[model samples]
Target: MNAPSSLALAVPALSLKDIGKHFDGLEALRGISLDVAKGEIVALLGTSGCGKSTLLNIVSGLLPADRGELRIDGQPAASFRDWRRIAYMFQEDRLLPWRSIRANVAFGLEAERSRRAERIVKAEQALRLVELDGFARAWPHQLSGGMRSRVALARSLVVEPQILLMDEPFSKLDPQTRAQMHQELLRLQRFKNITVVFVTHDVEEAVVLADRVVVLEPRPGRIRAIKPLDLPRPRIPTDLAVSEQVRQLRMAL
Candidate 1:
C-alpha cells in the first residue's frame, strides 16, 4: 500500500488535516483528519455527538472548522471556487411538497440561474438515472418511501456533482427499502464515478456501502480507527464475510 504522502501527490478529492470544531465551547471534533480519493466512497461512522455530521458540514462549506485545513481537489477550500461540484443530501428528503417531482429535481439548478429549458432537460436526465422518469409529474406525497428517496437522490444528482455528501439519507426507510437504496447509490456512484462521503450510525450500511469506514469516538470526537473494506460488491448482510465485518465494526463502535 502506498503511504499517505504518496497518495496526497495524486490529489485526493477531499482532504482535511487536524480538523476541529466547537459549539459554544463544547468541542464536537478534534484532530479529525481524512483523505477521500476521487471516486471513492467513505463513511463517517459514529454515534450521536461524535461529530460525524459536523465534519461533513465542514467539508460541505456549510460550517467552518474552528481549527484545521480543508482541501478540495488539491486546492485549499478557501480558495476553491467550484462550489457547484459538491452537493449535499440531508437526512430528510426535503422534497418540496408543493412541487412536482421534476420541479423538485430541478431545484438544485435554480441557484445556477440556468435556463428553465436546460434545467428541465437535466432534471429529466437525473430522474431517468434514478429510475424515476415516469414519476416526473408525481408529487412527493404520492410516492412510497423508497421512491421518495430516489427523488431525493435525483435532486442531488441533477447538479452533476463531483463530490456527494449525505447525512443518513436513508435512515428512515424499511430494511428492504434501505438495502435497495444502497444498491441504487452504489450503482449511481460507480456510473458517475462521483466521490461520496456520508455520515451513518449503521454498521451494516457502512460495511455495505463504504470503501473505507472512519470510526469516531465521542466527547470531543476523534478518530478511533480507519478500516478499509476490500470485500466483493453486493455484500449481503447474511454473508459470512460481510456479517463478520459488520460485527467487527459494531464492536468497534
Candidate 2:
C-alpha cells in the first residue's frame, strides 16, 4: 500500500489558498489553505460550527468562496464546473426515498445525459464495486444502516469522480458498522485511487481513515495544524503507536 505522503501516478487533486467565507457580518472561515494530493485521503477535524462543511461546499463548487483561490487538477475553480470530477457523500444517505438503490446510484449520471440503459449498467457496476450488487433492487428503508451507507458510497462512486468529499458520512452508524465503513472506505479509496477530503469531529475516525488529519480551530475556522499519519494502512486504533497518534491528534485539536 502507498504511504500517506508518497507520490503516486496521480498528480495534485485540489488546492486552496487563503480561502474564506462570510455571511452578512459573520465570518465562517478565514485564510484556510491546503492542498490535497491526488489519491490522498485527508480528514478535516473540527468541532461543530467550525466551517468544515462550508469549506467542503466551496471545494465542491456548491458555494463560492468569499476570498482566496482554488484549483482543481491544475484548472482554475472559477472557470471549472465539471462536477462529475468531484463527488460528495453526506452525513445522511440522502437517497431519494422513492427511488430504488440502483436508481439512486445512477442519479448523478443523468446530469451527464446518460441513457437510461447506460445509467443502469454503470449503477449496477458501481453497486458491485461496493459489494451491494445484491441489494441494488432494494429500497433504502429495506436495508441495514451499513447497507444504505454502502449504497450512498456507490452512488458517489458511480460517476467515477477524481475526488470524493465526505462530510461525516458514517457518523450516524453504530461502532461496528462504522468500523466496517472504515474498511470499506479504505478498500474503495485504494481501488478507485480517488482523492478524499473527509470532515469529522471524531479523532479516531480521522486518524484511522486519512493519510493526513487537518485540524481546524473553531469559531471563524482556521487550520490549527496538519498532522500526517506515518502509520501503516488499515490503521489499528488499539495499537500503542496508533493510540499515541490519536492522542496527539486530540491534543492538536
lDDT of each: 0.93, 0.90
Number of the top lDDT candidate:
1
Residue 110's lDDT within candidate 2 is 88
TM-score of each: 0.96, 0.95
State the lDDT of candidate 1 residue by residue for 176-240, as single tens digits. 99999999999999999899999999999999999999999999999999999999988888999
Name the regions of candidate 2 deviating beyond 4 angstroms: 1-11
lDDT tens digits, residue span 1-253, model 2 = 3635544534468989999999898999999999888888999999999999999999999899999999998788977777777999999888898999999999979888668998999999999998888888888899888999999999999889999999999999999999999999899898889899999999999989988889998779999998888898768889898899989877777
The model with the greatest TM-score is 1
lDDT of 2: 0.90
In model 1, state the lDDT of residue 215: 97
